[model samples]
Target chain A: MTALASDTRASRQPISFALLAQVILIANSFIMLYPVVVMVLSAFKTTGEIFDHPFALPDFTQVGNFTKVLGETEMPTYFMNSILVTGTSVILILVLGTMAGYAVARYESRTNTFILLFFLAGLMLPLKLAVIPLFILLRDLGLLDSRWSLIVTYTAIGLPSAVFIMAGFLRTLPLELEDAARIDGASEPRIMWSVMLPLARPPMAIAAIQNAVPIWNDFFFPLVFIQTDERKTLPQGLTTFMGEYTTDWGMLFAGLTIAAAPITLLYIVLSRQFIQGMTAGAVK
Target chain B: MLVSHKQAPSLKRQLWVAFLVVPPIAFMSLFVVYPILSAFAYAFYDWQGLARGEFVGLKNFREVLFGATMAPVVWNAFLHNVYALIALMVIQNGGGFVLAWLLYKEPFGFRFHRIAVFVPVVLSTIIVGFLWKLFLNPNFGIVNQALYALGLDSWAKPWLGDSSTALGALILANAWHFIGFPTLVYLAGMQRIPPEIIEAARLDGTNEWQLLKNIVWPLVAPSTTILFTLLFIGAFNWFEIPYVMVGLDGSPFGSTDVLGLVFYRTAFGNQSASIQNFGLGSALATLLFLFIVVFASMLTLWLRRREIQF
Candidate 1:
């Protein structure tokens, strides 16, 4: 009887410890998400109500703030610009990076190895350090204040990691397929395009998401290169909007929600893919 | 027919390879590699905007390092970057490590907790900065209100308004924004550990604390190296949060000034002024780049030496 009692006591200790851990984990997650919850809740409240009962649930669901931000500000335009820049840049990055990654993975040559090393070196080069020269370069090319400038810059900045990821993914693919395609008299381009490209789609998606997020979120380049209000990306536009509407807390919150909503919703929907893509780069 | 086709295809393949590779390489060289090299050259010439002036031969470096006008700003920004590095390492990465350990146990709702913690990471820094700014607002912000409600009103000062707490607040916000990254990475590292080794340690009557300390911690050394190196680089590279939240001047008496902001202001000027000195900006950039490279390499090397292999 004493032995059984001691066994129960020993077992009880780990269970109690696990319960403690669960409480801590839940509390930590709550703290992690509290600010985001506050933002969403405050967005639905009026300025008066927010101040009056900051912690309470909104008295009513209010779409008025969203309407005001979308209708009144240049927010829609900013969103369009962000989409145009990020979409074009991501497409170009995936295409070019995949090609480069294929070359590095399949072509066994000293030159190919050297090129891979060169691209890898770019991973360490903080583009912020080269902003001055890039600014001058863009100005000289007559590309300043143009969305194309951002597209090009983002593509260049994003390529290194994209290439690295694509190459790593491609290396994992069975070479037998490519070899068999070649034996069947398929041209190298055809093999790559039809055989390899389809298999590379998963990694392509990962690279696309990885590259797209930063470009969509980028404010630094737009702040420097873009001058016109219409040309501004969402992040840059949000900052300018905040500066102008510093006093209008309700409207500012609404504007922030507008800027954040699409990505936030996308993250919620495709969170598994997002998390996998993000962690894959580091883990591999 | 097959023999003739083989010769033609081999030549075509080389052309195809060139077509595939050259465009990205040329584009990267023109935009990335060329600019970096020119930045090195631009650091030596006393230039404003685009027109190059006479070669100043490290005069810009001298001004950035020791000149009465810019030295304090430079040093202050560098110090703040260091402070941010230390704070993020302790609070953000340290918190991430703890959370990873707990999650590794497969507690209830672990998946929900993982997803929730990582949600902020996908949001833009602009959104994060503005959201936090509103939350920390003294007059009507939730933080102050919550403090008052909890009867801790004495602790509810202006979080971002005062200089003493401004940087700290920014650090906390920054940590909040990125904690998920390290958490997931550490979790990945922890998952790589073999279950048999852990089960064996448990069979010897080791408690959770002992097993974690003796077995898990050493195995996750690679994650530690990766996280710390990234944190170090990111600390120096920080701009967007401070830029969006506090403005480029690192407001509240420049308490949140960082090297990235200083480089921006020096090169492009701010709302108050329009002094575009390319030489000094490039010099600052060069110094920052060199510091990051040297220290990061050293840290990585040291950490890698300590990493344990299973």
Candidate 2:
């Protein structure tokens, strides 16, 4: 009877330790979420109310920030451009990256090795290093101000990491599945699409989220490639908002809140997969 | 010999491979390779808008290497990168590793601690930048508010404005945002170590300290090498955060003028000095490329030596 109680006490100690640890973690998470929460609340506060009592509960009197953000600026246009650019770029990267990754993983040929190195080399080469000549090239193509130009640049940039992650994932997948598919009247493309890609979800999801986060947050590419206000994406749009209203902290925070919402919400929902995917990509 | 007999299958496979590889190759060559080569070509000529001048040979490279204005900018950028590297390798990486070590033993509440600290990792750099900007704002920012509340009003200064603190401020913000990444990576790496190894050490009268020093650290070396290399790349490509916080000129006294910012200013900014320096800009970019490529190659070599492939 003493031993039983002792066993329960011992277990309870670890549980109590765990509970304390959780409180600390919760407090830390609140610190992490503080700025995000502040921005979200800022988006709902009136300009006057924001400064009059910055930390107070935002007045339910007005939800004016969103209306102003949507109405007063080219934010809608920027949002559409962002979607088009990110969507098209991600598709191209996935398709091309998958094929390239598969070919590199499957074939043990010298040419395949060279191709892998060719793309992998770009992984270390910073995009800023190419900005000088890129500008000249785009100008010559008369694509400097165009949305598609940035899309093209983004696709190229996204491909290297995409290929690396996909290749790693492909290598780990059992080869027997492909061999069987090939034996069972499946062509290579059909095999990849039907058999391999469907199973490559773990890495693909990793690649997508990894690639998506950067593309969504990217400032440098759009900064250089797209000069026109109408063609700008969210980062550039936010910068424009900052330029016009540097002193308007409330509006600036509101704009930032809009920009941060989607990615943060997505991370909250998909964090487990996100972390797993990220670590998998990094280790590979 | 068997595949030679199956001509239809071989031809179809080849065709499919070609189809898959061609579009990406073409797209890459057009935007990536072509632009890079054009930058190389521009380095050999003097172009003052609309491709105006004769071949300058190595003059642009000479000016960038030997000229008065160009040398300091390059030095400043290199120094900035080194400072950032030190901060990331020391403060962020060190802090993260320590935290990870402490949290490794699933002592009640481990899950919450992991999730809380890692939230910063998922945020966009732009968002992180703006978030920190607001937090550090001199007037209405919470930082000042806290300082004043604690009766340390004189302790607060304009974080992004003062040249002395601007770079350091940016570094702190960056470290906060990215430290979680390496922590998680290290944690994942440590988790992969066989439990028996750790248990064996403990059973052999090894304390927690000895177990960690002998068993865990050695096992995590490969991951450490990879993390360091990646952090090096990230440091070298320091952009977005500085750009958002400090703008194109890297304000105050150009304290935050990283290589990325320098390249952007030279290539695209609407400054009179920047307007006619395409050749010089290309040369500078070429030099920056060589730096990163060489750095990456060296890291890969170092990584190969350290990698204990399990």
Candidate 3:
């Protein structure tokens, strides 16, 4: 793949053009990253200093903002709620999507094609369009104003893309692997579990990253459904905090940091997977 | 079928397939499909608060489509969405093609640059919106501050507060947040173009521009299709960015309003805005859904058939 990517003829551009191109790419990266860096740095600065020097590096030793956000506020509750809701939804999506995708991939039938299309349809039309009835449905189920409402909605929302990704990847694997497992007398579920699924890690990661990022960061459903502060996710909770602490730049930036840090750290650490996972659809 | 497993292996396989597929599809039916269908149904009824009052038979659609109060707002917001879609296609996707071209050339620190480009895409839209709102603040924002330092004080203004600039600023923010996506996707498409084709083209004396025009562009048609379809869907469904940056009301006289925000405010009723009109809101939602599905599907098929020509 590396050799293919770095084509020999492709590198034959003039040295001056390559230098100019590298400079432009570096500048673009700077433009992309500079503002986020400012947000993170502002979290560690004093409110007065943030106003005075918006671009200056903050004093790293000043742990006051972090402590205040963590201890003196509802940040922890929102954090936990985001984790619970996103974690639960992703788990359900992966499990259900994989099972459903396995069925659609291994079983060749008219029903399977229809099922795949049904799920694929969800990918194009966002669930947010149906929020009005969804809220009513949750109310009827006595799940509104609760994390369960968010969990179910996100699971449903994430499944279509997950199933699409999973099924597409599963179809690319050779049929002989499944035949070998069947000849070994493995049950259908066992063959899927031990053989097919292990090979499915790439798609699972892609689907997980695809779903989890949005689920963790989603504000709309939580904004409408979970009106109670106790059930509020990070994105929505951050807004309420932003309003209350509008003048307190230090705490505001700290709140933003807390909401953003986990995903940012994970992306930086596992960037290969994140990029591959998020952009997997376009490549196909 | 379950009982006849010993007599019929295919029937047994069918049972396994049902077991595997039913639970998830049922879950989706209960949550995603049912609610959406209900939302479409709600568009046909006159609603008194949450309950359906009577079958109004497109009266709500009339009010939403042609009523003096909503018609202008909805179309204006929709026009803004179109503007955003066009602007993003040009600035973000077009810029991305150039960036991908550069990266495809394998520039210095290209690997690090690839990761850097995607960092903003991973951040929440809310965070991106708010961060930009602060950056565009009139008095102390670095954007204005930098302008002043450069002795170009005329360029300084409240980017979000100004009616003329608010929607453009939001589009720019959206582009910033998502530009990495198109860049990488295009890069992936470019990498898939076998090197031998490029070598042959270079031997034919095809200049860089000619190579891009004649060889790479057509080959990357698939990525273009996916990106354009997604951009259309995303543009029409845009909510979070404007909602976060401008407010639920697409403020400064609604310069930044879009269908997603209008749908939310209508269905849920903002305290400062209109009261809840679930019927009318559902009409807008249903229309938006169908509009997206129809155009996106058509675009995909059209681009797909065009791809075969390459």
- What lDDT is reached at residue A232 by model 3? 92
Instruction: Give every collision pair in model 3.
Output: none
DockQ of each: 0.65, 0.47, 0.53
Candidate 1 C-alpha lDDT tens digits along B76-186: 999999999999999999999999998898888999998988988999998999888888889898888889999998999998889999999899989989999999999
- Alpha-carbon deviation at B249 in model 3, angstroms: 1.3
Best model number under DockQ: 1
Best by TM-score: 1
Worst 10 residues of 1 chain A by lDDT: A106-115
* lDDT of each candidate versus the true structure: 0.88, 0.76, 0.88
Error of 1 at B73 (Å): 1.5
For residues A106-162, could you state the per-residue lDDT of candidate 2 as single tens digits? 645456777778787666556657776777678888888898787778888888888
lDDT of 3 by residue, A119-199 (tens): 877766678889999999999999999999999999998899899888888989887887877777778888889999999
Per-residue accuracy of model 3 over B195-280 as CA lDDT, tens digit each:
99999998997878898888898899988999988898999999999998999889989989998889998998997855898999
> Clashing residue pairs in candidate 1, if any?
none
Where does candidate 1 stray beyond 4 Å? A1-10, B1-9
C-alpha TM-score for every candidate: 0.96, 0.89, 0.93
| Tens-digit lDDT track of model 2 for B118-227 | 77787768778887887888877767767887899899899889989999999999987877788788888888888898878866867556677777877888778878
Question: For candidate 1, what is the TM-score?
Answer: 0.96
Tell how far residue A279 is off in model 3, in angstroms.
1.0
